[model samples]
Target: MDLCFIVILLTFDVKSAPNPVNIAYTSVALSLHTDLVYMESPPGLQLLHCLRFDDCVEGGESTYLDLFHVVEEFRKSHPRYFQILSTIPATFHKCHYDRENPYHLVYQKPHIILNHRKQVVGLNWAPPFEGPLLVEEDDVLMYYEAYEELAKAIKNSDKILTYGMKVGDLMIFNNHRVLHGRNEFKLNDGIRHLQGCYIGIDDFKCKVQVLSNQVGDGQPPKHVGNQSWL
Candidate 1:
């Protein structure tokens, strides 16, 4: 991907006024969500580099949840709800003003995406951008109930990891399989800034393949089927 189009530098500081564009621009706690759920094909890999983290700052711990495990647990406990969420499409929208390019983006996709073998592979869940009910009236209640259950599980799950990122910390994760958020923070003595960039999964995979071919014998591994790339 072109560096000019793929990189996004993010600065998290207390703004004078609330920006309706994104919650990350504010100091409030951001809910656990997958980035760009409003897009049909969201970025695959996310990289965050912390440039500044003052000791005076409080409550700015980063949290991450593994959606793959969450979905597995949900399927075991609430099979029907899992089925509904995996099949029904929900609409997500983002309408914000940009001086250079104002935009309103919308997309419809099931909260859980499955692979050809019916295995959960991707997810799209963002409460902030979730649009109005797209399902029938009869199914709305069930949908919300399932949604609420899932949300609660994500928040209360013991697997969630919280880390206070320090200066020079770089965090990278698979955007498709992980849900990320941050706690409400207060900037007292210094500023908090983070630079970020996205790399397409295909590009990353190609690089890995090239490296492997250059270093390995010309034959594929015999245990390839047992290996899980994701």
Candidate 2:
């Protein structure tokens, strides 16, 4: 019908393949990570609508965590590691041909992003999608150490949330601020299906600002993953 943006909807279905490439389509657990870090600006907001999740499914609970909250604590404890990750650039790539169409995307960015005042504002920390590390000789060792420490901190953080999705469940979250993943599940003769979409940070925040002025909703600006340190 030509009604909406192309590639606007991404479907997640648990099915078997001769050699499954995409983990989202396989019945396996996924580590926590952000989506499409290969893009210059990864999606800001993510929406998922669960169309079917049978009651008999063994274990397919979705999980999420606020990276900002974790980063705040990491900065307090490992300030130097945080700074290293923020300054050193890491490469993220998406070169796959498993689907009907091929994808060859690449982007380079620091795992952490900071503003002039050195406050952590944004991040591009997706391990599964990470490409080769191409940096200066000195930064090679330093980046790995810092990256390892940050990963350990993320694993030790206790702020992660878990939820089991049911039919008709619609979930929306700030993709930049939250890391998302799913646990491996056994179908047990049942099926699970989920559809997802993304809203650009620029567009989403523009609407919020315009509406705030139009309706006189004087609430302060909320940091909804637009790289604002506040």
Please report the candidate that would top lDDT against the real structure: 2
Question: Model 2: what TM-score?
Answer: 0.88
Query: Over the stretch 1-230, how does candidate 1's per-residue lDDT look in tens digits?
Result: 55334434443332314444556867789888888878767776788888887788888888998878888899999998998898778899887776346768888788987766667766787888889877788888888888888888888999998999988999998787788999988888667777777777555554555566898664432211111324
Cα lDDT of all candidates, in order? 0.75, 0.81
Candidate 1 regions off by >4 Å? 1-20, 98-100, 212-230
lDDT, model 1, position 65: 88
| Residue 217 lDDT (model 1) | 60
Cα displacement (Å) at residue 83, model 2: 0.6
lDDT of 2 by residue, 106-221 (tens): 88889888889877778777899998888889899999999999899877778888899888999998898899998999888888778788877666666666677789785545
